[model samples]
Target: MATFWIVIIAIVALLLGTVLGFFLARKYMLTYLKKNPPINEQMLRTMMMQMGQKPSQKKINQMMRSMNNQFDKK
Candidate 1:
């Protein structure tokens, strides 16, 4: 009976530790990525142009307007 309780406790502790470690690792990864700047818009546009894909100005303006609206709500 004593050995049974010990085994149960060990399993519970292991499960809790696993969950904590997973969350901590995820938080660290997100923080690291946020600190490192991603590629710029100009670079992305240039790359797309090189691939023969021209994004329209009207589409860009619409996207900008939508983005502004989202920020205006806050």
Candidate 2:
């Protein structure tokens, strides 16, 4: 019975630790990304140009909005 309790306690501790770590990591990433988003208009424009497509302001704005929506979803 003592060993069983010990095992249960260990499992609970492990799960709690995992949940705490996940939240901490997520918070850190959110701050980091807010400071430095994964993509920028300049990069997107350059990418479009590289792909032989014209990078218009409307297109760039649309892409930026989509990128922001993706981040918000996560």
Candidate 3:
């Protein structure tokens, strides 16, 4: 009975430690990504152009309109 309790306690402690470690690692990673965004708008546009995908002003306007609609819903 004593051994069973000890085992249960060990498992709980291990699970708690793992959860804490995961949260800490995720927080650090998100902070680092925010501090250094992977790609900027200009870089994305250039890459798209290289891939034969040219952006259009009409598409931009449509996207802006959709975004505005979303904001207005709030």
Candidate 4:
């Protein structure tokens, strides 16, 4: 009986720890991404230029808005 109770407690603790760790890691990644986005206007411009396209302001703004909307959708 004691061993069964011990097993149950251990399982519960393991589940709790897993949930806590997942949330903490998620929060950290969100904060990190906010501080350092994967892409920005300058980077986008550079990429476009490298692809042999002129980076126009209007195009840049439109791309940025679409990218932002993509993230917002998630």
- Model 4, 1-74: lDDT tens digits are 99999999999999999999999999899788867879999999999999999999999999999988887676
TM-score of each: 0.57, 0.74, 0.57, 0.85
Using lDDT as the measure, what is the rank order of every candidate, best first? Answer: 2, 4, 3, 1
RMSD of each: 5.4, 2.0, 5.4, 1.3
Could you tell me the TM-score of candidate 3?
A: 0.57
lDDT by residue for model 2 (1-74), tens: 99999999999999999999999999999989978997899999999999999999999999899989888898
- Give the TM-score ranking, best first: 4, 2, 3, 1
Question: Could you tell me how far off, in angstroms, the CA of residue 17 lies in candidate 2 after the best superposition?
Answer: 0.9
- The regions of model 1 sitting more than 4 angstroms off are 38-46, 53-74
In candidate 4, position 46 carries an lDDT of 99
Q: Of the pair 2 and 4, which is ahead by lDDT? A: 2
Which residue pairs show backbone clashes in model 3? none
The residue-by-residue lDDT of candidate 3 on 1-74, one tens digit each, is 99999999999999999999999998898677656656545655676688788867675456556755664464
Which regions of candidate 4 fall more than 4 Å away from where they truly are?
none
* Candidate 2 pairs with clashing backbones: none
lDDT of each: 0.70, 0.94, 0.73, 0.93
Per-residue alpha-carbon lDDT of model 1 for 1-74, expressed as tens digits?
99999999999999999999999998887676556524445655676688788967665556556755664464
RMSD of 4: 1.3
